[model samples]
Target: MGSLRLTFACGDYDRTRALHEGTVRPDGIELISLRLPVEETFFRMMRHHEFEVAELSLSSYVKSLDQDPSPFVALPVYPSRQFRHGGIFVNAAAGIEEPADLRGRVVGTPEWQLTAGVWIRGILADRHGVPVDSVEYRTGGQETPGRIEKAAVDLGEQIRIAPIPEDATLSEMLADGRIDALQSPRVPSTFRPGGGVRRLFADPVAAEKEYFTATGIFPIMHVVVVRRDVYERYPWVAQTLTKALHLAKREAMANLYDSSALRFSLPWLIPGLEEARALMGEDFWSYGLEANRNALATFLRYHHEQGLSRRQYAPEELFAPEATEAFVI
Candidate 1:
C-alpha cells in the first residue's frame, strides 16, 4: 500500500518542529507540512477545509462542534498552549487598575472568540468577578485597518459586542484611548513610546504564575484537527497522529532540559525548563485527553458561558474515541 499521503498545517514551533522537519513521522502518513501563521491556518482550515489536518483555534474548534456535521474532529494533541495573563492591555489613564475596573469599560479584541481573548475574559470573569456581560466589547484588527471574524460567535443576550468602525483598528483605538482595554495575543502597537497603553497586570509573568498556582489551568490555545472526510476514511490516523505529536513533544522537552548547551537563543533555557516543571507538573506541556482535563474543561466552560459554543462540551467529547483510550501493559 502507498504511504497514506496527507497535508499537515500548523505553526512553526519547537514542539511541532520535529514532525515538520521529518525527525518524527506519523505512523504511515506522508505529510506535506504547511507551516503558516496560526491565524491564517485557522481561518483557511475552518472556512474552507483547505488542509487535511490543521492546528485549530481551541475556541473555534469548540464552537465548530455545534455545527451540523462539523467539518473537522480534533485530537488531544494541542500544538499551542498559552497563559493569557499577559494578553490583557489597558489604557494607563482608563482607571482600569484591576479586572473589576473593566466592568463599565470598552474593551477591544482582535476577535471576541480568539482563544487568547476567550481565556483572558474567562479569567477576568471567573477569578476576578468581572462579569463577561458587564463590559462593552469592540472587535477589529489590531494594527491593520480591516478584519473579519473567522468563526461565528454567539456572545449571548447579556453581553454587548460590536465591530469597530471599518476605517479604524483596535491598535488605533487603544493608542488614542478610545478603547479602555484590549485583550489579544499581540501587544497593541500603541504601547510604545509615550503611548498610554499598559498591561492590566503590570507584572504579567507574576500574575500568570499566581493564576496557574491558584487555578491549575495553563490555558490551551490550539489543538490538532483532521477534516471529517480524512478522519472517517482513516480512523487510524487519529491515534497515529496523536502518538507522533506526543513523541515530538517528548523530544522537545528532553532537549529543553538538556543543560549541556543552549539549544535555543535564550539564556537560562534549562533553568527556565526546570522552573516550568516546578510550577506546572514535570510534563508542563502535556498532550492527550486525561492529562489536560482541567484546562480543557475550564476553556469549554468559558466557550459556553461566552456563547461561543451552543453546548458545554466535555473534554472526552472533543477527541476521537480511539484517541481517548489506549491499551496498557
Candidate 2:
C-alpha cells in the first residue's frame, strides 16, 4: 500500500519539532507536519480541508466548529498547565496589590477573548467581585473579533476592551510600565524579563486547580483532530497515530534532558536539539487521552453555557471510536 498522508499543526515550533522528531510510526503513514501560528492553522484548516489531522487550541476548535461544523472531527489530546489570565502585574513602582487596584489601570493582552483573558475575567468577576464591564482592556492588535465573538457567545463579556500599540510585546510593556498588567500564559523564570514587574494576585496553577475542583472541567489549550473521512478510509491510521503520540508523550515525560528516542525521531526539525531540550522542562508539555477529554468536556460546557453552540456533544463525536477508551475525562 502507498503511504497515507497525515497532516498536523501545532502552535509552538519547538513542540511541533519534538513531535516530528519522535517515534512516528511509518507503517503505511506519511506524516506532514506544519508549524504555524494559531490563526493561520485555523484558517488553513477551514479553507483547504486537506489535512487528515490537526492540533488546535481548544478555544479555536470551538470557534471553528461554530463557523463550520461539518468538515472535521475534534478529539481531546492533552491537558496543558492551567494558565492564569486575570491576574494583575504591575511595576514595583506602581504599588497595585489587588484585583480592585486594576481599576483605571491599563492592561495588555494578546487578544480580548483569548482563553486566558476570558478565564481571568471570569475569575475577577466571580472571585474578586469585579464587574466584568468595568475594567480597561488593551490589545496589541492581535484580537480576532470573529473568533472572539464566537468565544464570547460562549464565554460572555469577560474582557473590558481597549487598544494598545501594534508592536508592543508583553515583556516590553510590563517593563516600561506602558501597561499596568498583562494576561498571558504562565511564564517560567527563564521567560520572565529581569526586574520591575511583580505578580500581585491570581496564580494560574492555583486558579486551574480551583476551577477544576469546583467545576470538574479542565480547560483544553490544545487538541488533535482528524477528518472523519480519513478515519473511515484508514481505521488503523488513527490507532497507529494515537499509539505513536502516546509513546512520544511517555518518552517526553520520562526524560526532558536526554532521550535517545527523540534524537532519532526527527533530526531535520531539531538541528541542534537545543530548543527541544529547553521545552522538555517538566512544566512545558503534557499529553494523554483522558486528560484531554476532561478538558474538552469542560470547554464544551463553557461553550454551551456561553451560547457559542446550541448543543453539547460528547467527546467521542470528535475522535475515532476505538480511541474513546483512552480518553478519561
Candidate 3:
C-alpha cells in the first residue's frame, strides 16, 4: 500500500523546519505540512479538527480531556516551550511591585485556558504568594476585540472569570488601568516607554532562571496532537510521527550548536547556547514521556488546581501509548 497522507499544521520553528522542508519525513506517511501562526493553527484545529495533526496548547489539550470523548490524542512532542516570567504585564499605577500585590486585582487574559496563562498563574500560585482565584480574571482579545476562548471552558462560581465588552481589548484595558495586570504570551502594544505597562518582574530573565533553579521546569507551551478519529483508524501514526518530531528537534539542536556560522540572528548564539547547556545540561529541550514527566505532571496538577480541568489528570494520560515507548534495537 502507498504511504498514508496527513495534513499537519504547526509553527515554523527551526526544530520543525526539517519536517516542513521535507528533510525529515515520518515513516510510512506523507506529510503535507502547513506553516501557520500558532493562534490560527490552534483555533482551527480545536474548533473544527482542521488538520490530521497539529500543534496544540498544552493547557487546552488538558482541558479537552474533560470532554466525554476527547477530540484529540497527543504525542509527547513539545514544539514550543518557554519560561513565562516576562509574560506578566502590569499597569504602572496598579502598585503591583511583587506577585503578592496581585491580590484582588483585575487581570486580563486572552483566554483562561491559554498555555501561557496557565503557566503564569501556576507559577504565581506555586512560588509566589498569589492564589489562583485571588485575582479577578477578565478574558478578551489582547489587541483586537471579540476574541473568545478557542476551547469552551466554565470554571464555575468559585473562580471569578468574566468577559470584557465585545468592543474592548485587553491591551487598551491594561493601558487604561481598567485591568491591573495582563497575562499573555504576546507583548501588548502599551509595553513601550510611557505606555503605562511594565512586566511584574523588572528583570524577567533573572527571575525565569531563578524559577527554573527552584522548580526544574522549563514550561511546555505546546504539544503535537492527532485527531482522535485519525489515530483510531491508523494508530501507528502516533509513534511514527513522534519519531520524526524527535529527529527534527535533534537536527535543530545540532544546528543551534554549529559554530561554523550563526544559525540565528543573535550575535552571541554560542555563548547563549553554552550558558543554557551549563545551566540546564545537554539535551535540555528533550522530547518523549520519560524525560518530561515531572514538568508534565506539574502542569497537569496546576491545570486541575486552577479549575481548568474537571478532575486531576495524570501526565501519562496526555499522550498515546504507542508514542510513549519504542522498541529497543
- lDDT per residue, candidate 3, 1-329, as tens digits? 99999999999999999999989999999999899999999999888889999999998889889887999999989999999999999999989999999999999999988999988998898889899989999999999999998977867787999999999999999999899999999999989865589999999999999988887888999999999999999999998999999899999999999999999999999999999989988988988888888899999988898888988999889999999874221
TM-score of 3: 0.97
Better of 1 and 2 by lDDT: 1
lDDT of 1 by residue, 1-329 (tens): 98999999999988989999999998899999999998899889888999999999998998888888988888888788888888888888888888889998999999877989888888988889888888999999899878989987755576888999999999889878899999999987788645588888878889999998998888899989999999999999988888888888889888877778888999988777788988998988888777789999998998888888888998888998777663121
Give the per-residue lDDT digits (tens) of candidate 2, residues 1-329: 67877777766533344467645453577787776776677557656765778765565565556554455655435523454642445665666777777767777666554555556655666566655566676665322222223233333454456555545455566667777776665441212444677676547446555664665554456667777678777777665666566555656544544544464465554433454345333333445545455655655655454344567765655566655544342
Q: Is candidate 1 or candidate 3 better by lDDT?
A: 3
* Alpha-carbon TM-score of each model against the true structure: 0.97, 0.65, 0.97
Return the TM-score for candidate 1, rounded to 2 decimals. Answer: 0.97
Off by over 4 Å in 2: 11-19, 35-50, 79-82, 85-88, 91-95, 103-106, 123-131, 141-179, 186-196, 202-219, 228-236, 257-294, 303-320, 326-329
Predicted structure 2: lDDT: 0.57
TM-score-wise, the better of 2 and 3 is: 3
* Structure candidate 3, residue pairs in collision: none
- Quote the lDDT for 141 in model 3: 93
